[model samples]
Target: MTTLSLHWPAYRLFPYERLLAIAEAIALLSSRQIAEDPESVTVTADRPAAAPRLTYFSAYQTPRTPPAPTVQHLIESETSGGSRRQSTRYSVHGLHEYKGKFNPQTARALLNAAGLPKHALVLDPFCGSGTTLIECAHSGFRAVGTDINPLAITIANAKAQALRCDPELLVAEAEAAFRAAGRSRRGRLLADVRGAYLHRWFDAPMLARLETLRAHIVERDPSVSEILLVIVSNLLREFSLQEPDDLRIRRRKSPPSERDPYQAFLEDTRALAANVRVVQRHTGVCNATSVRAHQGDMRTFATAAAARGMISNFDAAITSPPYAMALPYIDTQRLSLVWLGLVDPGTLPSLQAELIGSREFNGSPRSIWERKLVDNSERLPAAHAALCQRLLEMLGEQDGFRRQAVPSLLYRYLAGMRDSFLSVRSLLRPGAPFFLIVGHNHTVLGGHRIDMDTPALLSTLGETAGFVTERREPLQTYQRYGLHQKNAICREELLTLRAV
Candidate 1:
C-alpha cells in the first residue's frame, strides 16, 4: 500500500480543509498509532479545546458512561479471519448528525464543517426528516434526498425547499388550507374524522385546524403546499393524544378533543415561517435542488423510475439505509401517509420484509420481534439476516404466509442499496468520499446473533462497485429508544465509509 500525507487547504485540492485535518488523523492507513509532536502538528491558537464527545445512543442499553475508542483501537480489533466470528460492541461519538428526525446538532455540525464546491451535488438517500437536504440547502449546496416512504419524501421537499421561500406566503397558505378544511367538515369537530388512526390520536379541535392546513397544502401555492405537508408531518403526534413522543402507544378508542386546532395550526405555521427565515439569515441559502420526492421502492432500481435522471450524477453520497427490523415507517406514520393519500389505509402491511428481528414498539414493554429474535438462541448470524427473517415472517403471517416476497424484498433492498452505492461511485470524482451511515440490526434468528457492521459486509460491495472503505466510524447508541425490546440491538452501527 502507498501512503502520502499533505496538509489540507494548503493543497487546494479539496474544500473541507478544516475537517480534513481531523479526518486524516482518524483515517490513518496503517495499523500502527501515530501521535503528533507539538512541532509536527499545527494547533490552532484561537480554537477552543476540543469538545468532549457526546453520547449519541440512549434509552435502550444500560448506560455506562461512554469510553473513548480511538481509530487505531478500532482497526487493531478488527477480526482478520473467522474460524468463528466473535461478538463485540463499539462506541464512537459526535459523528455527523443523523439526517432529520431526532438528531439536529450533529446534522448542523456536519453542514457547518462541509466546504464542498459551490452547488456541488450532495445526496442523502436515507434522508429522515430531510435534515441533510435541509442543511444542504442552508449551506448553499445543491442536494438530493430519497426515501422509501412517501410521507418522508413529502416532509423533505417541504422543509428543504421552504427554507428558501417567502414565509408570509407559507403562513397565508396554511391559513387558507385550514379554512377550506373547516368548510368541508361543515362545522363538525376534527374528531368526527373518518380515518381510524387520525381519530384515535388527534384532538377534535387540533384535527379541525390541521385539516385546514392539509387542505391548504393540497390546494395552494406551489411553495407552501409542500411546506404545509411538512408542518403536519411533524405535528401529527402533538395534535394526536399519544402520550410521550412515541406513536405506537395505543391510542384512545376515541379522543374527546380539546385545543383550538385553527389556533394551533396558525401558531405552528407562523413559527415555522419565522424559523425558515432565521435559518436563511443564519447560514445563508442552502444549494439544494427543487426537491425530488419519489414514492417507489428503492429496491426496484430494476425499474426505470429508479434510474438516475437530469440530476443523475452525484458528487458525494451520504446515506443511512433503514435499520434492520426497525422503523416500520409505513405503519408508524400511517395517519399522515393516509391523510396525504401517500399510502392506502385498507391495504395494511403494505411494507413487510425479511426483517427477522423487526418488531414494533409495544405500548407497555417487550417486543413482538424479540420472540423471533431469540428463536435460535444457540447460534447467531449477522444482524441483517436476522432482521430480514423477522420481516419475511411478518409478511408471511399477513398474506396466508406468503414466502417469496420477503426474500425478493430482501434481495431488492440489498441490491437496491448496492446499486445506489454503485451509482454513487459513478457520480463521484475519483477519490471523492461517499460517507454512508448505516444501522446494524441485531436480533436472534435461528438462535444466533448477526452483526452486519456496514464496513465488513460492504467490503465486497465496495470492491464490486469500484470503491473502498476508507475509514470507519463505529456504531453506538443513538437513542436507548429500543432498550427494553429487541434487547439485541442495544448499539446502532454508524460509519463513514469513504470511497477508494
Candidate 2:
C-alpha cells in the first residue's frame, strides 16, 4: 500500500512531454499502477522505495505530504520561464549558445526511461553542444560524445569541465583574465589568413579587443582557459559584422562598439559562473574524468575508440542527429570557430561540406557524392532509395542548383546516417536502447512541396544497420522566435530503437 505521487509542470504544453513524464515514472519506480490527475500522477507500488530520480516531475510526495521539489525543478526555478524554454539552458548548458541542440530535460527523461544502472556508460555520437553529455553527468552516468564541429567539441568539454572545477576559482580566474586583457595592448595580431578574415568581419577597435582577450585566455591554465574561451566565443557574433539572428553569414547593418566586447564578456562570465554555482549546489560535483568528447566523424568514432583503448561497448545510446539539408552550422559559428582557433579560415568550405547532412557541397565533391550514392544505393533502405529517385525525377530544367541537388544530398545524408547507425551499434551492448529526437522537414521543388519524414527514414536505416525499431512518438515543438521561426520545424519525432 505504498503510494508515490509525481507532480509535473501544471502547464504541460506538449502531449509528448506528458507521455515522457509518465514513462519515466513508470520505468524508474517500477510502479504497479499509475493514476493520473491534472497536476500529478499517483503511482502505487507493492513496497516502499526511496524517492525516484526523475526528470519531468517538478516534485513528488508520499502519504499525502507536501511535494518535494526535484533538482530539475530547483535549477529551472532560477531562471524566468525556465520550466518551458529555458529548461535546457540551465547550469553550464547555457555557457555557450549553440543552435539545434535538443532539450536537456528531454534527454534526462529518455535516460530515466531507459532504466540504466547507476554510473552506466552512455554514448552520444553526435553530441552537438553536449546536451546529452551534461544531462548524463548530472544523473551520475558516464558518457562519451563525438562531434565533427570543432567549436562543438570545445564548448562541450568546457561545460563538462566547469561542473568539475571549483566555481569560485573559475570566476576569479576569469576576472583576472579580463582585467589582464583590458590592461594589455593588442599583443600579436593573428597573422595571414585568419587575421585577414577577422579584419573583414570586425571593425579595427573591436577586433583588437577580441584579440587581446584571446591572448589572455590562451595564457591561462588549460582547464581555466577552456572555460574562458567559451565565454568569449559566445560574444563573437554580437561583436562581429555577422547578423546574429540569421543562421547564414549575413552581414549586420550596424556593428557593435569596441567597449561592447569587454562589457559582454564580463556580464556573460558573471552570469555563467552564477549558473554553475547554482547547479553545483543542487547536483554536487560531477566526476570530470567520466565525460569525454572527441572532435571527429561519428561514422568512424567506434573504430577510433577501439584503437584508443576507450570503452567500446556502452549500456545505451541517445542522440538528436542532424536533419536533412540541416542548417549552416559552420556558417553560423564561423566567427567563433576562427576566433577560437579551432579551424582555419581557408578550409571552412571543405569542412562545412564534410559535415553529415550539410547543404554546402558543390563542384567535384558534389559529383563524387552523387556517384557514391549511385554505386551504393543498395546500402540504403528500399523506401529511402526510392524516395531519392522520385525526387530526382521530379526535378525540372527550370529548377536551380540547390533544388536539383536535393536528391543527391538526401541520398548522401541517408548513407551517412546508415554508417553512423552501424558505428553506434558497434559501441552498444546487445539489446541496448537507442533514442533519437529528430524533426521532419519539407522543401518546394518543381512547383511541388515534398515532405521529408526523416524519423521514419532513419528508423528504416537503423533497422538495416542492426537495430529493432520499437516505436516512434510524435512531439509537438514549442514556438520559436526570431528570423528563423518561419523556417522552424513545427513538429519532431522521438524514435526508439533497440540495438540487436
Candidate 3:
C-alpha cells in the first residue's frame, strides 16, 4: 500500500477511509501525531499558547491533564471490530436513555474535525436527544439544536440544564423532589384518564403512585421538575411489563428487575446528579447558556430562527437524521409521553403522524408516489437520478400495503432531508461544514429487499441544494450495534458537506 502525507480537516474522514480502494501511491493518512523538533519553535511569540488538543476517547480536558489519544488511536478503536462499548454514564449524557442516539465520542470527534474557531456557534438541525449540542457546549462552542419531537427537546434541554447546575445543588433539588413525591397522597386525580395500554402495562396502584409523583413534579417549576420527571420516566420501562432491549410493549411473564419503582427513581436521580459532577471535572462547565433547543420542524427552521432572533452565521453542525421508514420514535417514547402528560391516547395517533420516519399511512398513498417522482428528480446527479428511478420502478412492482405506502414514506423522508439541508445552508456561513451521521434503512419492494444507500443519495441531494459533498466515512458503532438487529443497516456514514 502507498502512503501520502498531507494536511486537511482531520475529523472529516473516518477510520473507514483506510478501507477505501484508492489508486496506488495515493493512500490517505489518518494520523494526527505530528513529529516535533525541540529546537524548532512550533509556538510563536505573536500567537497565544495553543489550546489543548484532544485525544481519542479522552474526556478529561484540562491543561495539566494527560495528553489526548492520537487520531490513529481513535481509528484503531473504531476498526477494532466488536460492539463499540464506551461508558455512557458520563455527566448529563446518562440522564435519560435516548433510543437511536449516536455516541458522544463520535460527536466530539466530528466537532474537532470541523476546524471551527473557538467560541464559534454550531447548529444541529435534527438534534435527536441533543448529543451534538452537548458536545458543542462541552467543547466550549455555542450550540443551537432543533427537533420536531418535543420529547427530544425536553430531554436535550434537561440534560443541558443538568450540566450547568452545581452538582450539590442538583442533588439537593432531586432529593427535595423525591421527598415531595413520597409524601404526595394519591386519589382519583387520574381516574378519568382512559387508556387500555396503560392499564395493561402498569398495575393500577403502581400507575396511580407514578401519576401522583408526576403531578407533583410537573406542578413545580419546569427547570428542576423536568429533570426529576425524566428520572421518573427512565424508571417506567423497568417498572412496566415491557422488555428492556426492544421498544415493543410486550408483557413479560415477570418483571425485568425486582427493585421498587420509587426507590429506583430516587437512586437514578442521585446517579444522574453524580454524573453531572464527573462531567464538570472532565469538561469544564459551560458558563454561557447559549444552547437553545427548539421543538420545531427542520423544513421550517428558517422561520423559527427568525422569530427567535437567532443568528444565521453558524460555523458548523453535526447531526444524525432518523433512518427512512425506520423506528417509530413517537410511539416508542409513548411511556414518557403519557407519564409527562404531554398527550393522552387520543392525541397519540396525531402526534405519530407528524414524525418524519413514520411507517403508518395517515395521508393519501398517491401523494407519496407523486412526491418521489417529482421532488426527488430536481438537482439529480446522474447516478443518484438513476438510483431514484430504479427505486421508483421497484415501487411500481410492489404489492399490498408496501405498494401503497413505501413510496410515500421514502418521499416524505427524502423531501424533509433535502429541505433540511437547504434550511441549514441558509443558517450556515459560506464554507461552514455540516456533518451528518446517518444510517440507511432497508425497504422491501416487489418481494425483494434492497439496501437504500442513504448517505450517497443524501449527498447527491445536498449537492443539489448547493452544498459541496466533502467526505463520507463509515461509523463502527453501527456495524457493532446492527450486528444482531434485523434491520438493513450495514454501517452508518459520517457524510460531510460544506455550505457553498
Q: Which one is best on TM-score?
A: 2
Q: Write the per-residue lDDT of candidate 3 for residues 2-61, one digit (tens) a residue.
A: 111222222222344322211100111222222223221111111112222332322111
C-alpha lDDT score of every prediction, in listed order: 0.47, 0.82, 0.66
User: Listing every candidate in turn, what is its Cα RMSD in Å to the true structure after a full C-alpha superposition?
Assistant: 13.2, 3.0, 7.1
- Which candidate's lDDT is highest? 2
lDDT of 2 at 439: 89
Q: What TM-score would candidate 1 get against the native?
A: 0.61
Off by over 4 Å in 1: 1-115, 175-185, 188-213, 216-220, 240-244, 247-249, 253-258, 285-293, 300-309, 352-416, 446-455, 475-494, 498-500
- After superposition, the stretches of candidate 3 with alpha carbons farther than 4 Å from their true spots are 1-85, 184-188, 192-197, 219-222, 253-256, 364-389, 395-398, 477-490
The Cα error of candidate 1 at residue 427, in Å, is: 3.9
**Per-residue lDDT for 203-248 in model 1, tens only?**
6656666665565567788866766666566556545666424445
Clashing residue pairs in candidate 2, if any?
none
Reference-based lDDT, residue 375, model 1: 54
Which scores better on lDDT, 1 or 3?
A: 3
